[model samples]
Target: MPSTPSLNDLRQQQQLAFLAQKTELRIGHAHACPLPPEHLAELDEHASEVTAVLESGLTARVFQLKLAGADYALKKARPNCLVQNLDGQTSFLNELQRRAEIDALRQRHGGFSGIVPTLYGSLAQGIILSPWLSGGTLQDWDERKLIQLFASGAELCRHGLFEWDFCPGNLIDDGRQLWLFDFGYMYRFDPLTQFNSAGQGNDVPEHHLAERIETRAYFAWLLEQEQTRGQDSALAAFRLEKEIAIEAYRKLRLELGADGANGDVLGWLDGLGQQWRQALRGDGEALYWQEGWRSHRLDLDDDIRGQTCTPRTLARCDWMLNALQGNFDALRSSGALAHETIRPERGALLDHYRRLRSQAEDFQIA
Candidate 1:
C-alpha cells in the first residue's frame, strides 16, 4: 500500500480539486472516501479478489470482481462526484437504486424484472457492485454481429427500462449476450426510473421532449435505411430483417401496456418503403418529399433545427446514429452496396448534430 493518509486530508485534497475545476473529481475512488487510509485499506483488502478490468472516459473504473460468491461488476467513482458536499446527492442516488431494486421486485408481480441494475453492494457513495450480466454490445462486432446485438437489444426493455437510452458507450457485450449497463441517464417517465442523479431527475414530456423526438427522428432515418438499403436479393433480406424488427418493436411496446402507436411510427417506415421503390426507378425526389413530410408530420422541428443539445436528447440521437452507421458499414462489407449508387442525403441530419454539440453542454458521457 502507499503512504497512509488521514481520511480528512484525503477529502480536503479532493475538495480543493473539485472547486478548482468547477466539476466533480473522477480519480481514485475508494481511497478518497471519507475514511482513514487504514480503514480504506481494510476495505480494499476485503474486496481484494477484484481485478481491474476497464476504465471509462469518465472517472469510474470497472472491475471484474466476485460478490456474493459470484462474478459481479464493481464501479468505483472518481473522487470528485463523491466528496463531502456531493455525498448527499451520491447517497441519494444509491438509495434510489436500492429502492429501484425493491420496486423492481414488487413489479415482478409476475416475472417482470425491472431495468434497475441488481445492486448487490455499495461502499459509501463511491463504489457499487451489480450482478454481472451475460451480455456484450452491438458496436463490438460486424454487421451480422451487430444485427444480433440489435435483435437482443430490442428485448432489453422487456427486462425493465421503458423510456431508456442505450448509447454505444453504455452498452456492454459480455460475450454470450448483450446487456444495458449505464443507468445514469435513466429516469422514470412513461416508463421507470431505477434511480436518478439527485439534481437531475427524470425527463417527462415537459422537461425533455427532445429525447423522444430524437428517438423518432432516428427511427425516421432507420426507416430511411430500411428503405434505401434494400433492392435485388438484399431487398428480401432487408425487408425480412425490418419486419422482424418491427414485430419485435410492436410486441415490445404492447408488453409495456402503452397504447399502440397509431401507425404514426410505422407510417415513416411505410413512406420510406415507397420512396425507396421510387428511388429504385431513379426518382430520388420521392425520398426528399417523404423526409420533408416527416419533419412536419412528426413535429420534429426542434431536432430538425438541431436544438436537441441536452444530455438525454443527444444520448438517444447517438444511439440511433450509431446503429445506422453500423448497419451501413455492414451493407458495404457484405458487398450489398457494390452496384448501388444510392446517395443518402443525411448531411442535414449530421449538420444538425454538429450544431447542437457545438454548444458544448451536451457532450456528457460521464
Candidate 2:
C-alpha cells in the first residue's frame, strides 16, 4: 500500500507547485472592466490610497479602492499563509485556478450567474481585484437566498467543482442577487462518480449540500436564535432550510440525471432525496436535533483546529453542553456522539464540555 503523505510533505508539495506556476502569475487586469489607471498606479506605488483596508486576515489583506467613479476590492496575499497548513498556503493560487475555470464555464454554460466576476489577479504578485460587492453578508437566510445558494452550489458540483468553505464571510448578497466571491477552498471533484474532493470521494457521504450549509453557516444562525429568539424559532429556521434543500436537491437530481451521470452519483442523490422527504414528512424534530448536534460539533472542531475561535465558538460549545445535559440519551441514540468512546454520566460530560468551552474562550480571535 502507498503511504499517506505527511503534513510536512504535503506542505512542501504545495510550495513546489506554487513555485512552478509562479511564472504565469502576473496580474492580468480584466479586459472587460479594467481597473482605472490611477488606481493601478497607486497600488504600484503602495500609496496612502491603499490604506483603505477593508479586511486584514492571516492570508490576505482586502482594501476598498475608489476610482473612476466606481469601487473595487483589492486583495493582496501574504508571503506565508498564517493558516499554518498546506491548503491555506496554496489558497491564493487555488482561487486563481477556480476563477479561471468558473469564468470559462460562465461563458459556455450560462448557469453560473451567482459567482462574483474576478476583475484582475496576479498569482506571482499575490493580488486579486474584483468589483466591490455592494452588499452585506448574509444575515437572515430566507428561502430565496437558500435556494440561490444551493442552486449555485449544485451547478458547481455538476461541473466537477466542490466548494468546501461556505462560511458567512465568503458569501455576499446584493439586493437583487447572491454572490460567492471566495474560491480559495473550492476543489475539483467527479460529478459523475465521486462525492467531493476529499479522500477518494464516496467514502464520506455526510459532507453534502445540506451538511455543508448546516456545518458552516446555518448552525451559527441557529445558535444566534437559540440565544435570542429561543429553541422554537431555531427549529423553525432549520425546517425552512431543509425544505429549501429538498427542492434544490430535486432540481439537481433532474439536471444530473438528464446528463446521464454515474449510477453511484444518482444513487447518492436518491438516498438524500428519500431521507429528506422522509424527514420532512415524519420526524423533522428528530432530524433537526441530530443535525444540530453534528453541525455544532463539527463547526466547533473546525474553529478550534484553525485556532480562530470566536465568541460564536463558545456559544456552540455552550449549546453542546446544554444538549448533553438534557438530551444526551437522545443525542447518542441519534449517532451524533458516535465519536465518543466513553459514555460518561451527565456530570462528567458536562465538566468535559466546560473545560472545552474554557479552552475555546482563551483562543478567541480578537
Highest lDDT scorer:
2
How does residue 92 of candidate 2 score in lDDT? 82
Name the top TM-score candidate.
Answer: 2
lDDT of 1 by residue, 119-232 (tens): 433434455556666554334233343344344443333443333334454556656444545554333322233112222233112222222322333333344444467323
Off by over 4 Å in 1: 1-48, 57-59, 66-70, 81-103, 106-119, 133-138, 141-160, 191-241, 256-366
lDDT of 2: 0.78
For each candidate in the order shown, give its overall lDDT on alpha carbons.
0.40, 0.78
Tell me how far the alpha carbon of residue 320 in candidate 2 is from the true structure, in angstroms, after superposition: 0.6
Model 1 score (lDDT):
0.40
- Residue-level lDDT of model 2, residues 220-321, one tens digit each, is 898888889988888888888988888888888888888888888889888998887787787477787789988887887777777778888888888899
Per-candidate TM-score against the hidden true structure: 0.44, 0.89
Error of 2 at 8 (Å): 14
Q: Which stretches of candidate 2 lie over 4 Å from their true place?
A: 3-16, 26-52, 56-58, 339-352
